[model samples]
Target chain A: MTETASLRRAARRYRLEFGGAMAAYALTVLGTSLWIDANPGSSARLPVALLPVIPVVLVVVAAVRFFRSQDELLRRRQVEALAFAFVGTALAVITYGFFETVGFPRLSAWWTWGTMAILWCVGTFVSSRRYG
Target chain B: MKNLLRVLRTERGWSQLDLAEQLGVSRQTVNALETERYDPSLPLAMRIARLFERPVESLFFLDEDAT
Candidate 1:
């Protein structure tokens, strides 16, 4: 297949997986919210809250599938990008922890994941361009 | 590292995609090899050499500065 064709195939698979994961997440969130609203402080609410982890796990699976689908060079580039994001996120989290002790606003745990995702995107762009 | 991937592909009248298909790799990988931005693994290099009917050393050379 041509380069464009291969890229399109990869993209198609990624989009399908991503869309499925997103749909699952949306459903889980909506279902859990409605359940909690109706039940009102029921003992099952905590366990129901954990139901969103199902979609989050699916998202992780989708990410792994996407990684495995890439060709070697692209895989290498992505690995490098993820490595950067991993280290950068760790450093950022550590710095934030120190700052929090010094009166900085205490951030939500989700911010770490969000920052890592953003860093992953930045790393992908930078690493791909460097290879090119 | 430097390689004659572009020259060999052109001589064979093969596009990067064609060569990549033959080598079971992506076109971006072939481009990276030709541009000297990435070096193929031993097996991949051997495959490239085999496809071009040349020795690996003949197709790829280490830059003096790369050493």
Candidate 2:
């Protein structure tokens, strides 16, 4: 029972789920962009913005499950990884948001992909440092 | 970290999983130690040494910087 908390095992499961969700997130963006572009006159702003929320929720859920019933060391390492990702993401988003509010061109469609790339790489580093 | 975990466990004929189970950690932790990717905290290292019936120094050695 206690052996279930192996970091590698937990990390492997999280990676698989995260990868699937990432694919869904990318497809959602591509599919929705195509639909919206085809109907440029349509008003689906709320729905369009909500599209990215799917991956966000999936990641959070996976993170929660990964930490469930674990010992403190493992739990703390997960938290450390999350903290790095969230803090890094917030800084990036706010910087971009500030630029946009000041009339800079918004990032291109592939911008969502950047978050996943950053989170995975940076989160892994943080986890390794904290847990290793 | 330099540890005699593998040696001690081998002497007792215990696999990494067996020792991990005794400590409530993952076999990955054991693997990490064997591979030197991770270093356990002092308490955990001590616990492991005790569990294997060896002195802490016999189980794990410190680098020059550790001192």
Best-matching candidate per DockQ:
1
Clashing pairs in 1: none
What is the C-alpha lDDT profile of model 1 across A40-127, one tens digit per residue?
9699989998999998898889889888877778899999999999999999999999999999999999999999999999999999
lDDT string, candidate 2, B1-67, tens digits? 6666777778889878888878777766777777666778778887887787777787676776346
The parts of candidate 2 lying over 4 Å away from their true place are A1-68, A71-73, A105-122, A125-132, B65-67
Question: Which stretches of candidate 1 lie above 4 Å from their native place?
Answer: A1-7, B65-67
Model 1 chain B: weakest 10-residue lDDT segment is B58-67
lDDT of 2 by residue, A26-71 (tens): 8887887787778787788569857977887897787677777455
DockQ of each: 0.58, 0.22
**RMSD (CA, Å), each prediction:** 2.0, 6.0
**Which 10-residue window in model 2 chain B sums to the lowest lDDT?**
B58-67
Q: Given candidate 2, what's the lDDT at residue A19? A: 84
Question: Which candidate has the top score in lDDT?
Answer: 1
